[model samples]
Target: MKTTVEQSLRAYLDDKTANGELGPGSRLPTERALVAQLDAPRSAVRRALDTLEGEGVVTRHVGRGTFLTESARAGAEAAPPDTSPVEIMQVRLVIEPPVAMLAARLATQADLDRIVECLQAGGASSTFEDFEAWDAKLHRAIAHAAHNGLLLSMFDVMNTARTLPVWGTLKRRTSTPERRGCYHQEHEAIVGALVDRDPEKAERTMRVHLEHVADNLLGRV
Candidate 1:
C-alpha cells in the first residue's frame, strides 16, 4: 500500500502529464524541487519515483535526472477499441463503486478540494459540451482520489474509450437538461460521501450514479 505522500505525488504527476505539462521524455523536477513543491518528505518522494519507475512510467540515470518514458506518453494518447455504450457502462458498474469506496477511505484534503472544484464547475456549465468535459474531469478526479495507481491507469483507459465519436453522439442524443440536473445532484451525493469519509455510502452512491448514467445512455439498467 502507498503512503499518503506517495499517493499525492503520483496524483500530481498524473495531473501534470494529462495537462501536457510533462510529456514524452520530459525530465521530472529534481528530488529537492519535488519535495519543496509537494511538501513531501524527500524519502517519500524517492519512493514514489521508484514506484513509478518500476511501473515503467519513468527512467533514471546516475547523473541525469528522471525522464518520462516514451511508452508512458504513447499509452496515454493511444486509442481504445470501439466499445459500445452498454459495454462501457457494464465495466464502469463493476469497477467504479469500489474505486469510490477506496477514495472515501484514502482521499486527502487536496484530493477532496479538486473533486469539489470539478463538481462546482460541472454544475455551472452552460453547454452540454462544457458539462460533459467537466463531467469527465469530475470522474477523473474521483479516480485519482482512489490513490491506487493500477486502478487509476485502468480508469484512464476506460475514459479514453468515452472519447470515441459514437459515445459523444449517443450522449448528445440522450442528454436533457433535467437529466443533467439529476446528474449534478448525483455528483453532489458522491462527493458528500467522500467528504464524510463514509466508504459504504460512497460506494452505494457511486453505484447509483452509474446506474442512472447507464439507463440514460443505454435506455436500460
Candidate 2:
C-alpha cells in the first residue's frame, strides 16, 4: 500500500479502537472485509495491517486472522498527523493547473474518451459515494493524460491524500446539489478546453475548478 493509504487506514482503525468498537485481543476484520468496508484495495489493507503489527497495534496469526493487541486498544486514542483541507487545496493549486496544460497538449483520443466517460458517469450518480468515485476517476484520467510519468506519480500521491477519511467527511458535509451542479459545469469547461486542444484555456479552467472546490469545501466563495 502507499504511505498515504496506510496512514488513512491506520487513522480509521485507531478511531474504531478509541471509540470502543474494538477492544484488546479482539480480532480485526478480515483483509477482504477491510477492503470492502474501507473502499480500499487489498494491498492497502494488507499493508495497513503490517504497519499496525509493526507498531504493536495488532497481531497476525497464521490462519486465525489478525487481532488488536492490548497496547493498541490503550494507545488508539492518539491522533494521527493532521492534513487540513486548505493544505490539500494548496498542493493541488500548485500541481494540477500545469498538469491540465500538459494534458491538453498531449492527451490521446482514448484519454479524452475515458475522461468524458467519468464525467458522464459522475453526472448520472444518485449518491455521493458513487459521485466521489467517478470524480476521482475523472481527475486521475486527466493526470494520466498529461503523459508524464513523474507528473502521473505526483498526481497519484495527491489522489492518495484525497483518500483520507477526513477528506470524505468534509466532502460529504459540503457537497450539495447546487455545488454539484456548479462542479459539473466547471468540469465540462475544463474538458471542453482540452477537447479544443487549448492548453491555456484548459489550465485556466482547471485552476478555476480546483479553486471552486476549495471554496465549497471551506464554505467560502
Candidate 3:
C-alpha cells in the first residue's frame, strides 16, 4: 500500500534526479539516511525506491545498488524551482491570521506591553538588517502572545519558509518612505486594537496589515 508520503518522497527524488545531480548509476543515500533527512518513515522511502525501480527510472540489479536510466539523467537537469510568493503567503495564511485571533483573546497587559516595546525597538532601528530583525521579532512576539502551542509552532514553520531567496529579492525591491509610513501606521493600529480587547477589530486590522505586507513585499497576493 503506497501512502501519499511515499508518493511525495518519490516525486522529490525524481526532481533531484532531473536536476542532473543524481547521475546515471548514482547510488543515492540509503533508506535510513533519507528517512532521517526527510524526517519520514522507513516504509515511505523504501516504497518510493520500489516504485522508481518498477517504472525503470532506476534499475535494481541483484545485489547491486539502483542505477538511474538515461531518461532519468535528462529529467534531472530541470532547474530547482525557486520558491514562489504564493507559497510564502500560504505559510503566513496558516500561521498569522489565527495567531492574531488568539492574541486578541489571550494576550495579557504585559504581553501587549512587551509587543509595544518590540515595536519601539523596530522603530529605533537605523539599518535595514537591524530593522528587519526587530520587525520579525516584533511579529514573533505577537505570535508568542497568542498563548497557543500550535500557533507558536506554526509561526516557526512560516518563519523558516520566509527565509527563501524570493523573500530576499522582495525585501530589496520594496521599502520606500511612503510605504514605510503606511507600515508603521498599520503596526500601531494592530497593537492598539489588541490593547482595546477588540478581537474582531484586531483580526480585521491584522488582515489589513498582512495584505499591505503582501502588496509591498511580494507584489503577489
Candidate 4:
C-alpha cells in the first residue's frame, strides 16, 4: 500500500496533467519545492520520486532535474507490422485538437519560445526532410505544452508512424512548395491562437489544420 505522501504526490501530478501544468520532458519541481508545495516531508518527496522512477514515469539525473520519461512513448510508438499511414493520421486527428486546447490554456513563455523556434526553422528549411523534421518538432512542442504525458506519448506513436515508407512516398508526391506554404500559414494560425490563450480558437484551428492536411493527402482539398 502506498503511503499518504506518495498517494498525495501522485494525485498532484495527475491533476497537473489534467490542467496542462506538467508536460512531457518538463522538469519536475525540486525536492524543496515539492516539500513546500505538497506540505510533505523531504524524505516523503524523495521516496515519491523514487517510486515514480521505478514505474518508469520519471527519470532523475544526478545534477539535472527530474523529468518525465519516454518509456511510455517508446511503447506507444512501437507500430504494428500492418499499421497504415492513414491510420496514424486518424489517431492524430483524435488527439491533437485537445492538445492544442490545453496548450492554449497552459503554455508558458518557454514553451511558446520553443514552438516559435521550430516554426522559424520550418519556414527556413530548404529540403523536404528538414521541413518535415521541424514540422514534427513544432507539433511535439505544442503537445508538450499541454503538460499531459499520456497524450504526448500517444503523439509520439503517431509521429513515428509518419516516418513509415508509405507515408514518405505519399507526402513526397503531394507536398509541393505551394502546399508547404499553405501548411506554414495554417501552423502560424494555430500558434497565434495558442499565443492568445484562446482555447476554443486553438482547438478549432488545429482541427481545421489537420483536416486540411488529411484532405491534401487524399487529394481532396
Candidate 5:
C-alpha cells in the first residue's frame, strides 16, 4: 500500500490543490492520463485514485474518472516511510577513520582521559553487549575530539547503522582466555598508538584492527 508512486502522486496532487489548481468537486485527469503524467504504472494510478475515493477526497463514476472531494488533500500527505540502511554506511566510510586520526592529532591530556576510560571499560567488559557498548563509547570519544561538529554529527548517524549480529556467536564459540586476551591486546595497541599522538600510525593501526574484524565477517580468515 505504501508505493513510491502513491507517495509522489499524493505530493503532486496536494501541491496542485493547495495552489487552487485542484479544487473541491474537480474531476482529475483520466487514470490512463495520470499514469502517463506521473510516469507511474496503471496499477499505481488506480491505487492512488482508489485511496483518494475511499477518503472522500474524490468520487468515481462508472464511466467518469475520480473527482476531488472536499477533504481530498487533508490525508494525502501522510505516507509510510522507507529508509535504506546502505545510506548510513556510506557516510561512515567517509568519516570514521579521519575521526580516529584527528583524535590522536588534537586530543589533550584531558580528552585522552575520557578515551582511556572508555578503552579500559571496553577491554574489561565480560558480556559481549557490554563490551560493544563501551567499544561504541571509545569510538564516540574519538569523534568528540575531531573539533568539527558536522563530522561528529555524521559519526553519530553512522554508528546507528552498524548491525553485527555475529558477535554473540563468536562470544560463545571463542569462550576462552586466549581469544578474549587477543581482543584486549589489539585494543590496547590502538589506544597506545593514539596516546603517542601519531595520527598516521594510529589510523593505520586502527584500520588493521578493523581489517581483522572484516576478515571474520567475510569468513575469509
Candidate 6:
C-alpha cells in the first residue's frame, strides 16, 4: 500500500500536469525543488518518483532530470490522421479562443504562475526549437487553466497533432526573429488579459494571436 505522502505526491503531480506545469516530455522539478514546494521529506519525494518510474509514467536519466513519458501524455484518444498544418491552425483558432476566455474566468494562482513561467521561458529562449516548445507549453497551460477536462483532452489531442513533421517543417520555414518577437508580445497581451480576469479580452486576444500565426504560416501578409 502507498503511504499518505506518496498518494499526496501523486495527486500533486496529477494537478501539475492538468495545469500544464508538467507535460509529456517535460522535466519534473528538481527533487530539492519538489521537497521545498511540497514541504515533504526528500525521502518521500524520491520514493514517489521511484513509484512513478516503475509505473512508466516517468523516466529518469542519470545526468538529466525526470521527464514525463510520451505515452503518459496521450489523451483519451489518438490524434486523427494526416492533419495538415493549415487545418491544425484552423482547428486551433476555433478551439483556443474559448479556452483562453474560460481560463481568464477560472484560473487559479498556481495556474497563472505556470502560464507566466512558460511565457518567460519562451521569451528567453535563443533557439527556435526552445521557443516553440515553450510556446506550446504556454498555450497548453492556458487550456488547462480553463478547468474543463474534456476541453483539456481535446487540446492535448490537437497539441499531439502539432508534433507532426509537416507542422514542424512549416514552422521552421516561417520562423524569423522579428516574427518571434511579435509572437512574444502577443503572448504577453493574452497573458495580461488572463491576469486581469477579462474573459472577452482574453478571447479576442487569443483569436488575434492565432490569426496572426495562421497568416504567417499561410504566407498571407
lDDT for residue 202 in candidate 2, whole number 0-100? 94
Pairs of residues clashing in candidate 5: 57-69
Q: What are the RMSD figures for all models against the true structure?
A: 12.1, 11.1, 15.7, 13.0, 18.2, 11.0
lDDT, candidates in the order shown:
0.81, 0.77, 0.67, 0.78, 0.63, 0.82
lDDT of 3 at 102: 81
Winning candidate number (lDDT): 6
- By lDDT rank, best first, the candidates go 6, 1, 4, 2, 3, 5
Candidate 5 ranges beyond 4 A from true positions: 1-94, 163-180, 219-221
lDDT of 4: 0.78
lDDT tens readout by residue for model 2, 1-221: 45466677777777887698878788888888888878888976775665455344666678999987655544344323376777778888899999999999999998899889878987887777667766777777788799887776566555555655788799999888777878888889999999999999999999999988988898432
- In TM-score terms, candidate 6 sits at 0.69
Ranking by TM-score: 6, 1, 4, 2, 3, 5
- When summed lDDT is taken over every stretch of 10 residues in candidate 2, the lowest stretch is 72-81
User: Which portions of model 4 miss their true places by more than 4 Å?
Assistant: 1-69, 219-221
Q: Native-vs-model 6 lDDT?
A: 0.82
Show pairs that collide, candidate 2.
none
Q: Give the C-alpha miss distance for residue 176 in model 6, angstroms.
A: 0.6
TM-score of each candidate structure, all chains considered together: 0.68, 0.65, 0.60, 0.67, 0.52, 0.69
Q: Compute the lDDT of residue 219 as modeled in candidate 1.
A: 66
Model 3 / residue 188 / CA error / Å = 0.3
TM-score winner between candidates 2 and 5: 2
Give lDDT tens digits, candidate 5, residues 1-221: 55477567767777888898888778888877888889998987776664344333466666876777544444333211222333333344457667778888988887788778878887887865556556666766777776776665455445533422243354355445555566667778777878999898777777666655544434322
